[model samples]
Target: MIPPEVPLDDEELVTRAQAGDLEAYELLVARHTASAYRTAILLGAGADAEDMVQEAFVKGYRKLSRYRGDASFRSWLLAIVANETRNLHRSRDRRTGLVLRAARAAPYSEAAEDGAVDAALAGERRATLVQALRSLPERDREVIVCRYFLDLSEDETVAMLGWARGTVKSRTSRALVKLRGLLDVEELSRG
Candidate 1:
């Protein structure tokens, strides 16, 4: 049995999965699950992220026959996860709020060097940014999250959002401007 970490390329796993190799499919899921969850979370799926990721994997498995070899398997799987997250968002009527998990602090020595005041300031800044992000329209938020938070390439964003490349670029530019405005307003209100 080949070890899961043997670095079999996604294309190979996908081919095996297409041949009804369950372990190959499982490996694909294991590889992409974290990223899928993060994308769901950034899209505001909240507690439903886990379910969304699971559903995406199941759906992806069922639809493996339709998956062309053109796109990377991870991108294709993520597009399905994005769609699942969007569907859940629509059905739930956007009930859950966005939760921004704070970054883990550095080692104790490094954290001590940074000091309590700096950490508090950083936390407050992060909170403000999260609030601003939550205030944007869902479409804008989705573009911003895909482009920035998820760090997806333009092509990947296009695939995930089912938008044209030009559309992705335009939306990302517009969303950034809107986000900046929101953050500015927040700063002004604080002052």
Candidate 2:
């Protein structure tokens, strides 16, 4: 189900977008721009990421007529973002490194802490987590990002990743295990 607070209904927005309503398209963009930006940034090609997002948005807007509405617009848009990000990396001929960077690093949260010690520790932890993520294989990293950070359900994740149900089940399990192992290392390092 679409989140109740999503500001507008998917069907209504799609209908409006189809009818050449520019504001309706803007509303869709407003609703998803953050996720698209974060996904691009996390993919670790800032310029490429921005370009990919813009391209994806344009493509998505053009293809609005084909939207089946089986998945919410957000999910469908995210799929495009993910695919475009992958394609951009491929075009640059740097898939492996970019994928690792995306998997290993996370966006630093500016508002996490204000106190000196807390802030320092949070920064360190964030960096450590990113390093650990960078160390994992691409499949593991992709799973972690889609499942945890993006807060997608199993079904949504399957759709976004274009993986089968069984693949998602097993891959999510493997990714969590790898992430935990990395976090454990962090704990040990801290102690």
Candidate 3:
């Protein structure tokens, strides 16, 4: 008896999804959900990040026929997530708090011996960075989050933002400058 072939790559899954394979589409959603959630959080969706990710996956699956297959499936999905997040933001009349929660500590770590001190310092730094990031204008924050927080490539950012390559580059540069200024001010205020 021959073993069933597994779809090893995103392209394979995407092709299957485009051909109306529900399992393939579900697998793609499982693979990309983390990234979608992270992008939603960075976009200030806050507690609604999970919902936005879910909605993005649903929208992507529904619009699968429109996918041109020029870019990676992850990029395409993230673009949907970004758009959903923006729509959520616009619909909410009140501003949602943008908070980057501290990462959970790993179990059975040597760092646990000094974890208290280390965690305090690390949390403080993370809080400061998150605060500075949240203070920037939405466009600047989006660029910074796409470039740094999400660790997306320039091309991916362009796809996600629906911006030209040159525009992504310029926006990223300007965003970084503004972020640095915000961080510097934060530092001076602390001292």
Candidate 2 ranges with C-alpha deviation above 4 Å? 1-7, 95-114, 186-191
Model 3's number of clashes is: 0
TM-score for candidate 3, residues paired by index: 0.87
TM-scores for candidates 1 onward, in order: 0.86, 0.81, 0.87
Error of 1 at 9 (Å): 0.8
- Which candidate tops TM-score? 3
- Model 3: colliding residue pairs: none
The order of the candidates by TM-score, greatest first, is: 3, 1, 2
What's the lDDT of the predicted structure labeled candidate 3?
Answer: 0.81
1-191: candidate 1 lDDT, tens digit per residue? 76576688999999999999999999898899989888777766677789988999999999999998766787788889889977886797754434353122112234444879877776777778878877877778778888887888888888788888898889889989998999999999989
Top candidate when judged by lDDT against the true structure: 3
Instruction: Provide the global lDDT of candidate 1 against the true structure.
Output: 0.80
Model 3: worst 10 consecutive residues (lDDT sum): 101-110
- Candidate 1 at residue 97, lDDT? 38
- Cα deviation of 3, candidate 2, in Å: 24
For residue 124, give model 2's deviation from the true position in Å: 1.2
